[model samples]
Target: MHPRIRLELAKRWSEPHREHHDTDHLAEVVRAVDLLASSGMAFDIDTVNTAAWFHDAVYDVHRADNVERSATLAQRWLGPGEGDRIAQVVMATTDHVAATGDVESAVLCDADLSILGADTERYDRYAHAIRVENLHVPDAEYRRLRSRVLARYQARSELFATAAARELWEDQARENLARELTRLGRPVAV
Candidate 1:
């Protein structure tokens, strides 16, 4: 990536309204992607790294179109071909599930969600930051909605698509999600 683009991304990620979805989170995802690459995974490192930088570039807890908007931002900034490739990867964050055989998407999604497998203290911090991001919502509504979204993730057959990610995060992510759901007074669904 060019120095100019990296600088621009750093500015966008540092926007004041952000909480968990800020520069630190961006760095964590990049680190996660690097970790995956160091494991000798077969995905295109540059492609996935580009996607990671732009994945949450337009994060807004109130907006339902963040993924699409992020993709558009990438296309606008990076231009047609390369931007479109990265945009396709950015769009996968909408659901955090990759189509089978899409190694780059799998890598990007896994890296983006790496926090879910963080240890309790860090995971709690991340959860708190997320709540902070959406503090505009009433407490009860937030709990209800958050629980549903987490349950959907829990219900998925696999949270991490790549074998490397599964080895690193899968079990811990399941435990963390279950613990959080219980804390929310929502039954932890399998």
Candidate 2:
């Protein structure tokens, strides 16, 4: 991906209404893709880059159709054939809820979880950002939701798909989830 294109995507992604899917989120995913690329995953870099820019470009947390909306936006932004590929990657992200998936989708999903494996300070900041982004929900409701999300991650076979991510991040992600669960007074997954 060109630096100029990345800048344009960053500008487009910098909307005030976006809570979690802002430029920082996109940047982090891009970094994850780079890490995966360096780890010899042979990812479709351009497709991943395009998908990262638009995955949450149309997010509506309450709307189940946001994935399709974002995919449509990706298609419009990237042009026909290339657009379809990017849309596929964007659509793959919805698999967490839809659970109908593919390898690239798995990679995207894992990359999204990469924040959990970040250095402690960055992980803490990411957690705080998520809480603030979701501050619209009442405290009790947020606690329950947060617990469910962390528990889901803890239950996964591996928090990430790529070998490098798994080796470098698996323990930290598990620890992050355990800490969050403990904070919410939920039983840690043994």
Candidate 3:
């Protein structure tokens, strides 16, 4: 990423509404991707790094198409081949799932969701910041909706697509989600 572009992304992430999804999250995901790579996952590092920079480049709580918008933003800043590939990986995050053989998508998605496995204090701060970001929703409604989302994530057969993430984050992620679910008055998976 160019210096100017990196600055622009920093600016975007610092937008007033962002709490948890700021540059801190961006840097954390980039670090997680590196961690995964260091664990011996082979994928195009440059493209994945670029995709990480662009993943939440266009975040908007009210918008359902931030990924598409972010992808377009990426194309404007990146070369054709890289932009196209970044768009593909970024879109894969829309459903938060990677295809069977897509190591890149798995890496990117897993890195992005690495927050789920953050240490207890960090995870609590993340949960609180997420709530602050969604203050548009009433408290009761937010709790209900957030519970459903967390439950669905907990119910997934595999929360992290990559073997590295499963080994590094799966247990902690489940425990964190279970803690949050209990707070939300949702059932935790046994």
Estimate every model's Cα lDDT from 0 to 1. Answer: 0.92, 0.76, 0.90
The weakest ten consecutive residues by lDDT in model 3 span 75-84
Indicate which candidate wins on TM-score. Answer: 1
Which candidate number would show the highest lDDT if scored against the true structure?
A: 1
Off by over 4 Å in 1: none
> What ranges in model 3 sit over 4 Å off?
none
Instruction: Tell me the tens digit of each residue's lDDT in model 2 across 1-190.
Output: 4576566667667867666668888889889878777777765676676677778777655666987998897787677997888788788677542234455665676777788888878888888878877777899998998899789879988777666778868998888888879988899969
Clashing pairs in 2: none
Which order, best to worst by TM-score? 1, 3, 2
Please give each candidate's TM-score.
0.97, 0.85, 0.96
Residue 68 local lDDT, model 3: 96
Deviation (Å) of 184 in candidate 3: 0.6
